[model samples]
Target: MLKKLYGKLEISINALESWMKERKNLAGLLVGIVILGGLIGCAIWLNQPVEGEVPTSASQMAYEKASVTAVLEDGAVPDYEDAEGRRVGTQELEIRILTGTHKGEIMSLTNYMSALFNVDVEKGDQIIVRIMTDEDGSYYASLFNYNRGIVLGVFVLIFFILLAVLGGKKGLGALLGLLFTLASIWFVLIPCLIRGIPAIAATVGIVAVTAAGALVLLNGFSLKTLCSVLGCVIGVVAAGGIAALVGNITPMNGFNMPEAENLLLYGADKGMKISGLLVCGVLISALGAVMDVALGIASSIWELHEQNPSLPGRALFRSGMHIGRDAMGTMANTLILAFAGSSLNMLILVQTYDIPFIQLINTDYICIEIIQSVAGALGILLTVPIVAFISARLMARGKRVS
Candidate 1:
């Protein structure tokens, strides 16, 4: 009788534990759903057009997707003497509009192709046409460009499929997190900046929100997530601060950027702050690398603590530092290379002209690029220690209590 009672007790405890585990998982799912819904709501609210905001003239122009039903003529004139010569000519095409108000309308269009702006197309190729409406209710159409949307869509679909197949549940979470980050930037950050919010502050706020959301989605609400988020935010902010300081010292503001003139012309009257945009750019560019380092350190430390709960905080800290050091070199190099690759054209120009080193270093564009690369690398470097320290303390303390 005693033996039977003991077996029954053991089975009952096991069943209860399983039930509690399922309940916990269900609760987590509910929480995740609620959070996702809230984020979507906020994104929608932020994306709404602001009252009194004037639309650009370009927005009034209509572009429609169309297919080249027939290529009526192809005239090409090529320059033989110039090494960089390109074909410049025009093609007459009959197209059928596939979208917008003119859907299924067949029309003849002229496609002017030049060395600088060209879209070579064959029959059945999808393209975009610019439609201009006259006061008399008549419309004229011209070739704008090739409609590459379908191709881009296919590429993106493949990317998602691979991510899902390789990453499984975690991959889906990452996909959601990526969408959330994009929404935060497009809906929240851009609008805030347009509304004249301090660029640096708005960027920082958005970074923090995105970082928190992504980490939570990936790891759930946990000590490791907290540590990672905190470390990431601090590292990003530090990078921005460094960049800002350098910009101030060099007297290089956003006006020194290539697109500054256009921005000033178009956005200054719309209450956009231009001066801090440089720092804002630095923060955004460094965010991914910094976050990677922070999460890596925090997760490693947490796993170490889990494997050996009795490990002291100092020992965990050392392990995290070791892991961080291994990551630091490669991550820093990644940031520098990314910045350099973006400016490859300028580098080529300098080399082609055989520009003096002094002149090259003093150029505003080069200085800005250097500042961006250095600040980002420094951010990654600092993030390692910060995340290591935070994760070590938190994980070790949690272990002792448990």
Candidate 2:
């Protein structure tokens, strides 16, 4: 099966019109994606609550600070109590609906209403929120904003349009690759894990499936696709091994992650291995960078081959390695800077307190973020060289089949 598929890849397209047809097909695909996404958005909007339905409200959204307000009436007794039986102060929050069918409604919200929050609310601070509303007009926020879907839809629209304009038919292939990735992760990986499959094995399997589907669908089943798949698989395994070793030696309270920690606290009673779940998180987080490193090196080798098909394996390996070196430097920096940018404010608090190195690095949140950045970086660095080295060995030993 692999031989037959590989043979087709080597057979060049002989007709110019076929290439144009591919372009038209891709253009149609982009249009279809945008239309489908827009339809979904419209469906969601239409199905949203009608007037006098329970008003959906959120607190300091889009930022980390809580929302607070003082009632106009003096001496409003606070209704919330903390763990120590001390009356936790309440701040009156004036809320307005920003979007949806119920666009204009004023409501009052508060901070410290739930045990999940710690930040003090103020007049102006933004935080992500999840809101809950019943079928009735009554509503109370469980968190901040409940509807991220609206924003997600807008971004999807922009992405499909941009892809259509940018690469035409190839863009369509990329889009298909993306949709397939999302589908497999949600449908195949998550279901397999929930059904008692080993998390590590499931992760490896999904990565393998995703990498092959994406690379083949984009580059076709050829040398380029082979190198990328092989590279990505190695990187994923390295990441899984590193995560497992680190987790075994120094297990934290593990609330360093969200649901995993909660599940751990609960799972201990049920005798489930929550540590396995944590390892899964680390593996999943590293998957993106692994694919990036693999594809980057493989694609560079392919482009080099196209430019000079007669180039020897040694030179092709060197080309891939050089390109990978440059890519790794920027990509690793990108991952770190992205983390720093997201946590700039928390970092400010660390700086303000002159936090001792021991306390700062040991902090649970900081530790987890570091794990995310560093593990991914290590995987990426290792992948670039591995892909280049193996591709060279394979190509050098082979005579191009006529």
Q: Which candidate leads the pack in lDDT? A: 1
Clashes of 1: 0
Q: Candidate 1: deviation at residue 169, Å?
A: 1.6
lDDT of 2 by residue, 1-402 (tens): 998877766564434546866776576557546744654454455345446643323332222222323332222234355434333444556555444433444456654443433434444444344455567956554335333465789999899989867967767767777777777677666655544567678778777767766765676556767788898889877876776676566564245566776666444443344446655666677777777788888777766666666778889888888889898888788778878998999999999989999999888778777776776777788899899987776655544410
Best by TM-score: 1
lDDT of 1 by residue, 1-402 (tens): 999999999999989977977786687668767866876786687668779878898999999999999989989667555525666788889999999999999999888877668788899999999999999999989888888898999999999888878999888877877878887888778877776789999899889988988887777766788899999999999999999999999987787887888888988887888898889889989988998899999989888888899998899999999999999999999999998899899889989999999999999889888888899999999999999998888888865322
Q: Against the true structure, what is each candidate's TM-score?
A: 0.90, 0.62
lDDT of 1: 0.87
Residue 103 accuracy (lDDT) in model 2: 40
Give candidate 1 regions above 4 Å deviation: 1-42, 77-86, 400-402
In model 1, the Cα lDDT at residue 214 comes to 84
Q: After superposing candidate 2, which stretches have Cα over 4 Å from the reference?
A: 1-148, 249-258, 265-272, 306-310, 397-402
- State the C-alpha lDDT per candidate: 0.87, 0.65
On the 0 to 100 scale, the lDDT of residue 27 in model 2 is 69
Inter-residue clash pairs, candidate 1: none
